[model samples]
Target: MIETTPGIIISFVLYLIFMLLIGWIFYRRTQNLSDYILGGRGLNTWVTSMSAQASDMSGWLLLGLPGYAYIAGLESIWIAVGLAVGTYFNWRFIAQRLRKYTQIAGNSLTLPDYFENRFRANSKILRIVSALFILIFFLIYTASGFVAGAKLFNTVFGLSYIGALSIGVLVIIAYTFLGGFMAVSWTDFFQGMLMFIAILVVPLIAIGTMGGIDSTAASINAKNSELLNALTQIDGTTISAISIISL
Candidate 1:
């Protein structure tokens, strides 16, 4: 049987309730399409950047990264490092251009609008293609989140896998539909903070429980000496657990 932590469970429940409350509070602000879809583009830089990264990463950062590290090894750090590098590049190169273009193109909100205005395309086919790309990728992205949520529910609460998937998708859709981008952004910022803190603290707690990094390493080695060994042996290189787990 698994050991339980009442404090952790209670705190998590409170956090969920807080998210639900925030969603409700934003419900009234979404009076029209623009408000729902773009938060009327009123978010300041800090909120915009935080929400952008939050929406981009979602649950992947919180659960997948560390799990990868534990399963694979040091190689998993590359995924996290790459993500940080990519985010930095996006902010440095893309963010300002996007913000400026979004405004200059007669306040175009959706990306397709920006493209249509930028190219002055004759057929609007470009816009259609852009929309299709967004729809396809966002669905893929959101579906991945559903998968993660299912895993989380199954791991933490022993919830039925199908039920967890349904609940996860429904909750995401409900909140997104009700409040739109602003809602998504605000929640993303909040969720990002929670994820950041949780990821940071969980390791410290684990290390404390395990008596430190050296002890933890020794214990893991005791269980599986091969895991502690180098990646290659006799031209049979092992796949790093970190990358595999994160992916």
Candidate 2:
């Protein structure tokens, strides 16, 4: 849990206000379904890529991944490598082609819409089924984001879990309602920048404070040399290929 302070509270309040303000600004600009749903398809390279990455990794990268690393030691490297390779292929092969295809497919705005037009489904069954699938999966997926937000708020502010969750839900809905895609993309860009800094800078600072990279490695090795092993678990067991694939 975090120690509460006036500065911390003030900082959070200010951040929320800033995010809300951006949403409001974009709300005024959103004139139609296209603008609201796709940000007029006008996002620059930086905003689009950063927002995609921000939304993709979310809190899992910060909270869950690190916890796994602390337990599994260097076995976490496989996860990182997989993510990097997957993201590269996704952007290079799929996203670019899909963007153009969406425009060609009767200016489809959503994934289901794209599939419906792309396939010329006269029955509309494809669209309905695809939407249902998306809803089912996204409900589960979005729950993770909500839970992460609740945990962060609960830990940082000493709020009850319900209270934290309520606040997080309200804020998320308000922003999405206010600015739609444009607001989300812009806010996500900044959030991703902050997450990037937190992920890298925090570890670097901790290592430096512990002495340096060499000293930190030495300290960990003193506790368990296997912590430095990339191909094995912290228990000195070789990590199985099946475990890697499952992860």
Candidate 3:
């Protein structure tokens, strides 16, 4: 959990306002189902890609990965490397092809609809099955996201867990219900920028606070020298090949 400050709180309040404002703006523009779902296929490449990659990751990248790194040292990089590779391949091949195909098939609004159309399935079985799987998986996934959000809010705002959770859920629900895909994409684009900046800048700030690279390394070395080694865990165990493969 992040420690809160006045600056952090102010920044977050502004961000929330911006997101809600975006939803309200888009809500007025949304007149038809297509506009609500796909933004009439009008999103530029930047918005699409930012939203795609940003939405791909959730609490795991921010919270879980950091925790893993603290526990496993540099061995946590296995997950990072895997995600980097997968994201590249996904961007290089999957995204564009999927977009074009979905448009050609039927301008499908959802994955299940796309699959049903792509396969030319006469029965609704394919769509139904896909929808069920998505529902089951997303129930778990969305719960995790909410949990992450709750923790983040509590950490940064010094709020009670239930209060934080309620605020987070209400903000998300308000925007999503009002503006749909346009709201989501635009907000995600800005949020993605913040995520990237945080990833790049936070460590540098930490290093500075610790006095420099040498001091930082000395601190880590004092605790556990194995943390400097990419293959070793903090507990002095060698990470297995299977562990690497699984990551």
Candidate 4:
């Protein structure tokens, strides 16, 4: 947990203000259901890419990955490698085909709509089932983000858990209510950039603070020799190279 300082609090407040301002700015543009739902399907490649990445990752990139790496050391690299390969394949193969298919199939805007249209299903059951599943999963997904936000706030500001959670929820609801899709996309782009900067800067800072890579490596090896190796024994169990790759 980072120590709570005036500068950190000010900066966070300013960020929230900027996000709300963006919502206000985009609110006028969101005139109808389609615009609110899909940004009118008019996003450019960069916005689309960043927004997709941000939405997909949410707090996972900031919190979950770092936490996993801290605990698992080099073994965590396998998770990163797998994700990179999967993301590449998804972008290269699935994205274009999905976009084209969605456009051809009655201009479907939502996932449930797309599924129903794609199958040409006469029954409303498919849509209902899809919507129910989506609602359930999405609630779980959203709760994770809220929990991450609350923990972050509590750690940084020493706020009560409920207070932090309420703040997180309110801020999300406010911006989302003001401007639906566009606000979310634009904020996501900003957040993606912030995450990229943090990922790059934090490691460099940590390495420097620890007196460079050599010193850090020595400390890590002293603590747990296996942490220095991507595969093999960490404590007593030998993790095979094949198992590492499979991970």
RMSD values, in order shown: 3.9, 1.3, 1.8, 1.6
- Quote model 4's TM-score: 0.94
Whole-structure CA lDDT of model 1: 0.76
lDDT of 4 by residue, 34-64 (tens): 7898888888999889988988888888899
* Collision count of model 1: 2
lDDT of each: 0.76, 0.92, 0.88, 0.88
Tens digit of lDDT per residue, candidate 3, span 1-247? 5677789889889988999999999999999998999999899999998898777787777887888888777888889998989989988989889889998889898899899999999999999999999999998987788898899888877789999889888998999999999999998898888888988999999999999999999998899999988886777888888888788
Looking at model 3, residue 20 earns an lDDT score of: 95
Best by lDDT: 2
Question: In model 3, what is the error at residue 116, expressed in angstroms?
Answer: 1.1
Ranking by TM-score: 2, 4, 3, 1
lDDT-wise, the better of 1 and 2 is 2
| Cα lDDT of model 1 by residue, 141-241, tens digit | 88888898888877887779998788777766777776778878887888777776887898899989999999988997776655554452222366566
Clashes of each: 2, 0, 0, 0
Instruction: Return the TM-score for each candidate structure.
Output: 0.83, 0.96, 0.93, 0.94
Clashing pairs in model 3, backbone N/Cα/C closer than 3 A: none
Please identify model 1 stretches exceeding 4 Å from their true place.
1-14, 221-247
Better of 1 and 2 by TM-score: 2
